[model samples]
Target chain A: MATTSLTTETGGFEVRRLWTDERSRAIIFQLLVVLGLALFIAFIVSNTIANLQRAGLASGFGFLTEPAFFDINQRLIQYTSESTFGRALIVGLLNTILVSSLGIVAATLLGFSAGVMRLSQNWILSRLVTAYVEMTRNVPVLLQIIFWWSILTELPKVRDSLSLGGAFILNNRGVRMPSPVLEPGFGWVFGAFIVGAIATFLVAKWAKRRQDETGQTFPMLWVGLVLIIGLPVVVHFILGQPLAWDMPERMRFNYRGGFNITPELIALWFALSTYTGAFISENVRAGIMAVSKGQSEAAFALGLRPNQTMRMIIIPQAMRVIIPPLTSQFLNLTKNSSLAIAIGYQDLVSIGGTILNQSGQALEVVAIWMGVYLSLSLLMSGYMNWYNKRIALVER
Target chain B: MTDQAFHRQQAELLPQQPAPATTVGIVGWARTNLFSSWSNSVVTLIAIYILWLVISSFVQWAFIDADVSGTDRFACTSDGACWAWIDQRIQQFLYGFYPAGETWRINIAFVLLFPALAPWMFENVPGARYLRWFSIAYPVIATILLAGGLGLTVVTTDKFGGFMLNLTVGLAGIVLSLPFGIILALGRQSRLPVIRILSIVFIESVRGVPLITLLFVSNIILPIFLPPDVALDSVVRVIVMVTAFASAYMAEVIRGGLQAIPNGQYEAAQAMGLSYWKSMRLIILPQALKISIPGVVNTFIGLFKDTTLVIIIGLFDILGIANAMVSNPDWLGLSSETYVVVALFFFIVCFSMSRYSVHLERKLDTTKR
Candidate 1:
C-alpha cells in the first residue's frame, strides 16, 4: 500500500485532521482526564482544609493518642475507657473480625445444609426451606439484626438469669459460658496437638500417594483422627489433666468468673449468618443445579453411593460454579457484619463513630474505615482468586 | 402351564384403565412427595409439626388473641401482640413527619410514577413512545413535587421520613445511578487506559466498603468536602453517597451485559463508519441495557433493602420509624410487633420484585423459542 501524505493539500493546514488522529487524541484525552481528576482533588482538599479551619478542628493523627474515654462492652482484646483511641479501635477491629469469622462459619454450614435440603426428595422439606430463604433474604438485614437483638434483650435480667446445666448462663445482659483454664503443663498438650496436626497432613499426603500408585485406598480419616485427637488426649493425661473449667457463678448483680458473650455479638452473629445464609443457599442451589443431571446419573451407574457421588463427582464440578459467588457472599457477610452498630455491637465502625464524635476526627476516622474495609476486601478477593485458579477446569 | 397358555392367547389388548388410587392424584402425590421413604416420612412429619407451631403461634399473636382496635398501646389487654399501636401510628409509618396536609403532593407523585415508569418498565404500554418524555423528566417532576419548587411550600428533607423516605431515597438512587453506571461501565470497557484505570479504582473502592462507611462520610465528612459556605441537605448528601455506592454495582452488572455482546457488533459498527458516540447510543447500549434489565432489577432490590441503613445515621426510613416507635415511651415493649410489621412490608415489596424479575427473565429467555 502506498503511504498516505500527512496533508492532502500542502498549501493549507486542515485542523479537522487533528480530530481524526487516534494517537494524539488518545494522549490528549488521557491528559484531560488526569487534569480533571487533579482539579477535582484540589478542589476537595481546599474545601476540606477551609472547613476544618472554620470548624476550629486541627486534623491530624494527634487525636489517636488521646484517651477514648468510652465504655465498650464486647471488647475482644483488653480495652478500658481510659485506653487511647488507637487501642480501642484495635479492640473494635478484633471484635469485628471475631464476629465476622463466626458468622462466616455458621453461615456456610447453614447455607450448605439449607441448599442441600432445598434440593431434597421430600417436598415439604424443600418448600419449608424455600419459605425460610425467601423470608430471611427479603427482609432488610438491619431489621433482622434489630429483631434478634430485641428478642435477646427482652430476656430476663441477670438476677433472674436462665441457667443451662450450671455451665452456661443466659440473661438479658449476655450469655456466660464456662471457659477452659489452661495450666502451665497444658502447653505440652498444645505442642502435641500441633505435632499431631502435622502428622495428619503427612498421613493424608501419603495415603493419596499410596492410592494413586498402588490402587489401594488407605483409611486416612480414622488414622488421621487417631493421630490428631488421641495424641492430644494422651498428652493431656500424661500431663496430669492440666485443663480445668472456669465455671460461671451467678453473683449478686451479674455472673462472674466465665467467658461473657454480649447479647450484641450473639444477635449480630446470628442475624448476619441467617441473612447471608439465605443468599448463599441460593448460590449453592444454583451451583448444584448447574451440574448436569447426567453427572450424578453417571456416578450412580459406576456403583457409587449417593453421598459418594455428591462428594466425588457433583460437588467438585459444582464448586467451580459455587466458589466464585461464595467468595462474594463471604465478603458481603463480613461487610454486613458492620450492621453490628445498629444493635449496639461495638464493632470497628461503631467504635470509630464514637471516636469520631469524641475527637472530631471525622475525616481520619472515615478514611481509616474505608481503607481497612477496602484492604480486607482486596485480601479476600486475592485469596479467592488463588482458590479459583486451583479449581478452574483446564481446557484446551 | 394351561393358565400361562390362556394368558398368552389374548386376542386383543385390554382397554386402558385408570391408574390405581395409590398411584394417582393426591394420594400418589403424598406418597411420592411427602412419604416416599421412611426417612422422608419422618422429615415430613417434623416439618409439619414445626410449621404448625410457628403458624399457630404467629396467628395467635397477630390475630386470634390480639387486640387490633385501639388508640394507643394502653388499649391492649391481650396476652399476645398489641397491634393497636401500629394502627395508631400507621400514618406516621407511611408518611413519617411529612405534614398531613402536604401528603397530597407525595400521593400525586406516587400516582404519576406508574405512568412515568410504565413506558420504560414494560415494552408495550399504550402510547409509550409519546410518554417517553414524561419518563425522562420524572426525576425533575418528582423533585419539584416532593421538595416543592413551583407554587408549593418547601418542606426540608428532615421531614422526609418513613416509608415515603424509603421510596424516595431508593428511587433517587435507582434513577441517578443508571446513567452514571452506564458511563462508568463504558469507561471500564474503554480502550483508553486512563479512563479504564480510574473507572476500575472508583468502582472497586466503592464496592469494597460497606455502605455504612459511605453513609458515615455523608453524615460527618461530606460537609467538610464542600466549600465552607455550602451546606448540603443531609438527605441529599445521603442520596448522593448511596447513588455513588450503587452506581459501582450497577456498572458491574452492565459490564457483564456488555461482555455478553459479540465483538462483531463493535466491529460492524466501526465498519459502518459510525462514530463511537453514535454507535454506543444507537447500537451497543440499547442491546446491552436490554440484556441487563433483570440484573438491574436485582440490584434495585438490593438498593431498596440497603436504604434501611439510613436509619443508622438517624434518618427515618420505615425501619427507622419502626425503631423510633420501639424506643418510644408508650410503645416501649412493642418492638416485636413493630419489627414484624416492618419486616412484612419489606418482604411483600422485595419478594414481589424478585418474582417480577424471575418472570421477566423467563419472558426474555430467547433460547426457549
Candidate 2:
C-alpha cells in the first residue's frame, strides 16, 4: 500500500489510452503498413503506365515473334539472323546453362583436389595452394574473364596453328577438334548402351542385396563400367563401326568442318571455374576441419591406412558440412555467368539486353530474367535443402 | 645389491647428445614435412616444379621485359607487358574523368576517410567520443567537399568515373543500407505477423535474384516507375539499387546476430518496464551489432567487389576505364597489362578488408575458448 504513488501518476486525461495500449498500437501499425504498401504499389503502377504511354514504348511479349536480326556467334541449336527474338533468348539461355553445367563439374573437381592439397602434410604444397586460393578468390572474376580472353585471342593465327596429332587444331580463332559423325547402324550401338545401363542398375541392386545376405562383396564398380562401356564398344564393332570422326581442316581464312569451342566460351568457362573453385575450396576446407580429429584417429586405431581413413571415415563425415555451401557456391557461379555479357559471350542477359533495346519492352525482358533466375534458385535450394535434411545428423 | 647399484647416478649426466645429422634442425623439418614418404616426396617435387613454372613466366612477362614509360604504341614494342599506358593514364584509372585541377578535393575527401572511419571502427581511438560526431557528419562533409556547392565550384556526378566511382557507389551503399538492414532485420523478428511476412518476402526475393538483374531493373525499368517530371541521376539510381540489394543480405547477417542473443536479455529489459524501442536500443541492439561487425565488413567487401558489374551497364569504373584505355587509338592493345593493374587493385582492396574482418572477429569474440 505504501508503494502506491497516486500523486506521481499522470492525470487521467493527460494521455490517450489508445496510443498506450500495446495491442492497439500493433494493430494500428500493421494496418498503416498495409495501407502504405498498397498506396505505393498504386502509385508505381499508375506512374509506369503514364510514362510508358508518354514515351510510346511498346509493352507486352508480342514482340517475341519479331525477327531478332542479330547474329549470335555461338549456338547449341540452329540459329540464324531470321530467327524470332524468343528463339534467340532461348539460345542464349541454353548457352548459359551449358557453360554453368560444365563450370560446375570442373569447379567441383578442382575444388576437391585443391581442398585436399591445402590439408596435405607437405608444407610447400599446402602453402602454394593457400596462396593460389587467396589470389583467385579476392580478384573480381570479370577481370579474369577479360584476361583469359586476351590470352586465348593472342594464340598463333591460323597460318601457324598448333596441331595435336592432326586430330585437333588450336589458333587465335578457337580450339577445333574432331566432331563425331554418326552413320547408319549407330542406333543399334545406342540401344545397346541403354540396355547396358539398365542391366547395370539391376545388377547393382542385386549385388547390394547379395552382400547383405551372404557377407560377400561383388566388384560392382568394375562390373558396371564394363557393362556400360564394353557393351557399347562390342556392339559398335559388330555393326561395323558406325561412328566416324570429322576432323578439322584448315581453310584459307579459318578452320572449318569440326566441332569448335569459341575463345569466348573457353574464357568464360576457365574464369568462372577457377574463381568459384577458390570459394568452394574454402568451404571444403572448413567442412573438413569441422570434423573432429578424433574421428580420423579412431579410424586409424581400427587399422585403417591414411587413404582408407580419409576415404572410409573422414570424407563421408565432411560431406554433410560441405554440401550446403557447395550448392550456394554453384548458385553464385551460375549468377556470375551473367558477367559473360561484358566479354560478348552472348549469355541470357546479353541477348535479353538486345531484345530489350530492339523491342523497347524493358519491363518484359527484365521480368523474364528475374523470373528465370529466381525460379532456378528456388528449385535448387529446395532440392538441396531436402537432401541436406535427409543426411543431417539426428542429434539427441 | 642390484638396487644399490641402480641407485648410483653419474656425477656428470651423459653430455646432452646432439640429434642425428639427418634428423636435426631444417633437415629434420624437411624430412617430416616434404619427404615423409615416397608419395609425399613426389608431391612436393611436382608442386615445386609447377610453382616455379608459374612464378617464372609471370615475373618475366610482368617485369623483366616489360616497358615502363611512353605515350603510344611506340612505347611498348617488347613481348612483355606494356606498362607505359598504365603509367600515363594512372590518373584516369584512379580518378576517372574528374578534372585534374580539382583532384585535391577528391584527395582530401579520401584522406578524411581514415579519420571518419577510425572512430567508428575502433572505440578507443584518440578522442573517439568527439570524433564520432565527425564520423556522423562525414557523409555531408564528404559530399560537400566532393561536389563543392557551399562557396565552392560544383562538380557533377556524371564527371565521376574510374576507381572513384567504385568507392562512391560502395561507400554510399554501405552507409545508407545499415539502417534499412537493421529495420528489416527487426521487422523479420517482430511479433506482428504482417510485418514479419513482408520482410521475409522482400529479403528472399532480393536474395534469390542476382545483382546484375537488379542493375538491369535500375537501369531500364526504374525511370519508368518515377514521375515524368523527376529525373534521377544515373549514379544515384545505381547507389539506390546497390543499397537495396545489399540491405537484404545485411538483414540476414544482422538477423543471425540477433538470434544469437539469449531470450533472457529481452525478458530482462521488458521486466524493467522499458518500452519496445527503448529495450531494443539500450539492450538488444548493442549486443547484436557487436556480434555482426565481422559479417558487416565481409558484406562490404563483397559489395565493393561487385561494383565492377557497373562496367557492364556502361558506367566507367576503373575496369571500364582500363577497357577504354586499352581500346584508345594511342594505345591500340594492352589488355593484359590494364587488366592486371585493375585486378591487382581489387585484390589488394578486397584481401585487406577480408583480413580486417578476420581481425575484428578475433577481437569481438567473447565466447569461452
Candidate 3:
C-alpha cells in the first residue's frame, strides 16, 4: 500500500511538471502574441475612427447601390453608365473570369506542347522551344503585353484592313468574326445542348466503368463529341434552323455588323496568355523531367506503344507533379488579368478606382476589394486542396 | 586461329575509318543539329528561309531605311524600324519629367551606388563583412538623389513616377523588405506564440490580395487613416506598400531556408553555451542565407518584374514609359520597336540575375549527394 501511494504521488508530480515545462513556454509566448495583436488592432481601430471623424467622411458599403456614371469599354454582361455600382462590379467580375478562363486554356495548351517539345530528341525543335521559353519568361510580362498591344494597334486601319479569306478582318479595331444571332426556336436548341451535355457525362461514366470491368477501351471522346455536336445540330434543324449569321462588312469608314471584341481585351488576353504560357511551359518541362527515364523505359518494356505509353503511363504521373505549380500559374494569370486596366479593359479594380474617385468612398471601395480578393483566394485554395487530394499518391 | 584473329582485326579497322568530310565542321553541326533526317532537313531549310526573309527586312528597315534623328515622323519613311522617335524621347523614357538640367544627379547617384554594390558582390573586396550596412546606406543616398531634399531642389514624388522611378522603387523595396522578411521569418519560426501569430496574419493577409489592390489601399485609404494634416508623399506610400508586399514573399522564402538547416547545428550551438540570439545571428542565418540565395534572387527578380504594376497607379516604370512613348502621335505606329527595346533591357537585367543565382546555387550546394 505504501509503494502504490508513492507511485501515484510521483505520477501526479510528473504531470504537474509537464504542465509547467519549456513546451508550455510556447503557449505563454502564443498568449503574449495574441495580446500584442489585440493591442495593435485596438490601436489601429481607434486611430482610424479618430481620423475618419476628423475627415468628416462616413465609412460603409452603401456606395455599392449608387449609380455608376462611368462607361466600361468591354463588358461581357449587360452594363451601362446608368447601371448600379453593384451591376458594374458584376460586369468587372465577369470580365475577369472570362479573360482568366481563356488565358488558362490557351496557356495550358501552349505550355504542354512547348514543354514536351523541350524534351524531344529532335535537337532543333527542343532548342527552339527552349529559346522561346527563355526569351518570353525572362522579360517582364507587362512589357510583352505592351508589345503585343502595340502590334495590334499598329495594324492597318479598318478601311485598309487585312481580310483573311473574306471571312475575318484584322485591323486596329480588333479581329472581327461572323457572329450567330439566335432566332425564335433558339430555346429548343439550348435545351438540346443541355441534354447533349448530360448524355456526354453519362456516356463518359459508363465508358470508364466498362473499361474498369472489361479492360476494353471505348472512344469516349469521339462519342462525347458526336453527341454534344451532332445532337445539337440535329435538334437545331428540327427546330427549323434557329440561328442567323451576322457577318462583318467593311463600310466606308469602318467594319460593322458583327459581335466586336475591343482591341483592349484582345491585347490583354494575348499578352496574359502568351506570357503565362511561357512560365507554364517551363513548369511542364520540369514536371516531365522529374518523371525518371526508367519509368518510360519500363513502359516500353511492357509492350506499350509510344503514344499509348505517353498517354496512359507518363502524362498521368506527370500531371501529379505538374498540378501544384500549374495552379500557381493559374493564380498568377488571374492576378495579371488586372493589367487589363492599363489598356483600359475595365476590370474590377479599375472600376473600383473609378467609383472611389467619383464618390470619395475610398475606405468602402478598398474594403470591398480586400473582401472580394480574399474570398477569391480562399475559393482558389479550396479548389487546390480538392485537386491535390484527388491526385495525391496513395501509399500502403 | 590466325585467320580468325585477322578477320577480327579487319572488322576493327573497318570501324575505325575516318568519317566523311561533309560530316564535320559547321556544315556537319547544321546537318546534325538542324537537319539530321529528311523531314528535319525540310524543317531546317524552311526555318532558314523564313529567318533570312525576316532578318534581311528587319536589317534593311532598322539600319538602312530607319531615321536616327528628327523631330517629326516625316523623316522616318524607311521600311525599317523608326529609331528617331527613340532618340527624341530617350531622356523621357529614362528619367520621365525629372528636371532636364538635374538629370546628372541620377547619373552621379548610379555611379556612386555601383562601386558600393560591387564590393558586396565581389569576394575579393576588402572589408566584405562590414558591407552589410552599405545596403542600408545605399538606399538612403539614392532617395536623397532622387527626391533631392538635402540642400538640393525638391523633386516631388508625383513627378517621380517613371522608368527610373520604377527601378528605384523596386530596388528600395527589395533592400527594405529583405531585413524585415528575415526578422518575420525568424519570428514565425520562434517558440513565441505572439510573434508567430502576428507573422502568420501579416503574411497571409498580404499574400492573399493582389499588389494592385494594395497600391489602391495605399493610395486611397492609407491617407484617411493618418492625421488629416499629415500628408505622405505618393511615392513614399507606394514604396511602403511594395515593401510590405515583398517582405511577405521574402519571409516565406527565408523560412524555407531556415527550416532546411540541420537541427544538430542548433543543438551544437546550445551545447557551446551560446545564447539563442548569438547562435541565430552568427551560425543559423549565414547557413540559412546560403541555402536560400537562389530563392532570394528569384524574389528580387519577381520584385523587379512586379515594379511594372506601378503603372496602374499612374507611375511610369520602363514599361510605362514605353507605353507613353508609343501613345505620342508622332510615334503612334512605333510601339513594336519601343517595346522590343524595353523587353531587351528587362531580359538583360533579369537573365543576368538568374545566371548569377544559378552560380550562387552551385557554389552553395553543400548536399552530399
Best by lDDT: 1
Residue by residue across A264-312, what tens digits does model 2's lDDT show? 9999999999989988898889889989999998998988899889887
lDDT of 1 at A63: 84
- List, residue by residue over A205-243, the lDDT tens digit for candidate 1: 998999999989888889989999999999999888999
Which portions of model 2 show Cα errors greater than 4 Å?
A: A1-15, A195-221, B1-12, B21-23
Cα RMSD of all models vs. native, in order, equals 2.3, 3.4, 5.1
Write one digit per residue (lDDT tens) for candidate 3, span B243-308.
999999899999989999999999999999787789999889999988888889988888888888
Per-candidate TM equals 0.95, 0.94, 0.87
For each candidate, the DockQ is: 0.85, 0.78, 0.50
For residue B360, what is the lDDT in candidate 1? 86
Q: If the candidates were sorted by their lDDT against the true structure, best first, what order would they fall in? A: 1, 2, 3
Error of 2 at B167 (Å): 1.4
- In model 3, state the lDDT of residue A147: 74
Locate the minimum summed-lDDT window of 10 residues in model 1 chain A: A1-10
lDDT for B175 (candidate 2)? 95
Docking class of 1: high
Q: Pick the candidate with the highest DockQ.
A: 1
Over 4 Å off in model 1, which ranges? Answer: A1-12, A213-223, A234-240, B1-8
